[model samples]
Target: MTEDSASMAITLSEQDKTTLRIAAYGSVTLLSAAGAAGGSPHKIATTGSIALGSATGLVGHVLAEYPKSKELNGRSVADIADRVLPALTAAMSLLKEQAPEEAENFRSTVITAIESATHHGQPGPVVADMIRKITKALDAA
Candidate 1:
């Protein structure tokens, strides 16, 4: 039992290190994606926030795809849902201040719908809406 416990600790530590490394690389990808999304037409501040949010969303998507991380490895679906929902919420908050009011409202509704569906354990609607919004947003950029 002692040996097994030590091995698990080592594995967890390695997983944490890997997650951090991936997260750092992911952050760079996010920054690039956001900058590409925020072309020259937007207000400088608005573009910056959207760029940040876009990067964050990209990072969240990537992290969520990973099967395990020290923080998320054994968490329940609800716990995962809890973490997933907030990224979108935070993105919406940043976007609301920067995006057109109507566009911001639509994105917020889309995120809320996704979160509600995830909470209910039927996430198809939420995912579909999210994908739709992402496609639209990307195309508009």
Candidate 2:
């Protein structure tokens, strides 16, 4: 993380840090799927690269604050989906405007990721609720 990034994350609580991590992970996953969704590679690459850069920065911020640990990381992922739902909604809205087909692709990719995350154990009501919320957001977008 850059000095600025590290500084910005210093004041965040653990929950906030977890939310940032989840949002960044979601952004990267969606953008990667978008890049592969058959389009002008140049356009997708341009947009994906820019968005990935920002998302990676946030990921770095979270990582700097909390080093990777399976226990903490697992719990964080389990707790993060609902908290980051709004961020995901906003991202879906933007992608829908900029690249409608890719938006759908991104939404599916996110759902898959969420499902995979839940496979290890049951996600709490929050994760289940966020999945529905994300589905609605993506459909509306």
Candidate 3:
């Protein structure tokens, strides 16, 4: 058999598998929220549920991945929040296109989350950049 035809298997540790799953689920969930945020009340409800579920999954994944490292877990959570903020700002912008007041609410919610995530210390350049981008988006929305 050719190399392409031969049976090929790859293995990952359980932790690695779980991490991959969590990342995939988180991305899909966030994308779905962004797509649905401009729709009706039912769609908003669905998006909210998915967002909460994804947050829970992330918490569990962080706990599993850094069971004995508080500092690591905190840093990981902050990094994740930073990464997610842009997508979230885009989603809020979509919501703004549909409902301006509700979009403002969403912006406030995001600002609160960002503040909570970064309140422990001064944000570095990366986190500050994310905050600036998010603020500009929210303001323009």
**How do the candidates rank by lDDT, highest first?**
2, 3, 1
- Please, what is the whole-model Cα lDDT of each candidate in the order they appear? 0.34, 0.44, 0.40
Which ranges in model 3 have alpha carbons more than 4 Å from their true place? 1-90
State every prediction's TM-score relative to the real structure. Answer: 0.25, 0.39, 0.37
TM-score of candidate 2 relative to the true fold: 0.39
RMSD (Cα, Å) of model 1: 17.8
Clashing pairs in 2: none
Task: Give lDDT tens digits, candidate 3, residues 1-141.
Answer: 532222112233454334333332333233333333333324433443344333322232321342122211224434544444444445555545544434444455445444544454565555466556556645664
Worst 10 residues of 1 by lDDT: 23-32
Tens digit per residue, CA lDDT, model 1, 44-68: 2233233334322323232233334
**Residue 94 miss distance in model 1 (angstroms):** 0.7
Give the alpha carbon lDDT tens digit for every residue of 1-141 in model 2: 664454444354565545434443543333333333333324433443344343223333443342233322323433434434555665566545544444454565555544543444444454455456556655664
Clashing pairs in 1: none
Query: Any runs in candidate 1 off by more than 4 Å, and if so which?
Result: 1-74, 101-141
TM-score computed on alpha carbons, candidate 3: 0.37
Query: Residue 128 deviation, candidate 1, in Å?
Result: 12
**Model 3, C-alpha of 14: deviation from truth (Å):** 32
